[model samples]
Target: MKKWAILVAVMLLAINFSFSNGAGEAEAGGKEVVLVYDGDAFFSLISTSLAFHEGKVPMLLFKDDLAVQQKFIDDYGADGLIVVGRHVDAALPCREFLGDAVAVSLKIAEFFGKSSSVVVMPCSMDEYNLSLIATPIACYTDAPILLYDDNDDEIISAIDKLGAENVIGIGSVAIGNVHLKSEEEIYDYISDIRDVGYLAVTNPDDALKPEVTESQEMSFERHMKNIQITILSQKINLVGSDEATFSISVPDGISRIRAIVDVP
Candidate 1:
């Protein structure tokens, strides 16, 4: 009997997500910022909380049930109001009242014109985390944020609805996975736009420590056929070896790593 075991170790990659010094100023010099959130706790927490914290933009929970919108208008007295989604009623007085997240975002992008971009994310709980991750980009670009989910067919129907063509995605979001890229790539893209410091560190010891390691059996016949494993984009080939031990070398600057083995 021939047995083989492959030990894979990956180091943790740390990237700097610290807020920019003048990020708050990006939202200033325009108007007293008001973010019209859907008022859903989960959605607001992940979507607008960081924007409020980073850009000094106060969030107004826009729910149709509450008639406090007028109070918000009177107290804050915002020069312009930007709505995150259409579900909320816009009774506030403003130069314009836009409907739907996409539409509202487009209205704000008008200020930046050709230099503007929009941040899109899935509306479901699983995907809303990207909103928080991408909030800094939104604040920096002064872009509008739009969210979508699997069920909402109208989610993407409004992407180009407002005539804003420069579109960017934060996490597991795209035009049907056509531009599926790694998270590091997205962060790098944001860094390019903002020119901020990014740091990444890798620690593999914690990840590889396991009580039990899975083993595999290779017969003479299978050994003659050869075996291979693929991790990320790297591949390791095992041919005619009864037993072997090896350590894979991953290049620096790679923010993430994953290992996969296929058995047939």
Candidate 2:
């Protein structure tokens, strides 16, 4: 009777462990594949949207240490890997998107098949802000975000091949029948859908760094406050008085700002 009880207890523990492991895998959305990219390259970051569009797979920056990368895969329970960038070489069962940003974008689009629409944004390998804004929109819309150049034959050809009826352009990109939008306009449009949350702003000077370690949450918080100040200043401008005095109150717990005597 004692031996039977011990055996039952061990079996129960094994079943519980298996259940919890299955639960974790389900929580990870059964996405047992992760995309790896070189954090040191700006283009690598931009191309990550391909992975995002491909089943919303998770992405990790490629650490120099192979052990670290393998550990991440184990933690995420991922069995397969997709590597982006020509220089990134991951030692695993993986598919590689190897090329320049434009080439990689086109290849990924072709690999995932086409949609009725394609997002065309100005391509700047050095600047990331515009691409960052475009990534989520592309993923949400289920359209491929192609880096645009002025009258580039390759981009025009890709758009034609994709059979994209709607060519949505962001930030001064003027392709054929493309709907161009300014940065401010894009911000206003996405503000409705995007939750106001902490942002991690990367420094342009440190674009080539292997990893980003600083938190810019406080800086972003201040930027939000500045937007408030700008709105208040605009309202004050509506008074249309050359010499009007007004008191500005700073909310509690908010950082103080310099007096805006003559904000133009």
lDDT by residue (66-101, candidate 1, tens digit) is 377656555655444444444343443233334544
Single out the weakest 10-residue window by summed lDDT for candidate 1: 2-11
Clashing pairs in 1: 11-203, 12-202, 12-203, 14-201, 123-148
Candidate 2 segments exceeding 4 Å error: 1-32, 39-45, 63-65, 87-91, 125-127, 176-178, 191-264
Give me the displacement of residue 164 in model 2, in angstroms: 1.3
RMSD of each: 18.4, 19.4
lDDT of 2 by residue, 1-264 (tens): 100000000000001111022113212234434344564354544455555555555566665545566775777666455566644444434556667666777776776576787777777654445555545555455677777656478878888888888777776677746554644555554454444232234443332223433323221111111112246456333433344344445557544344323343
Global CA lDDT of candidate 2, please?
Answer: 0.52
- Choose the strongest candidate by lDDT: 2
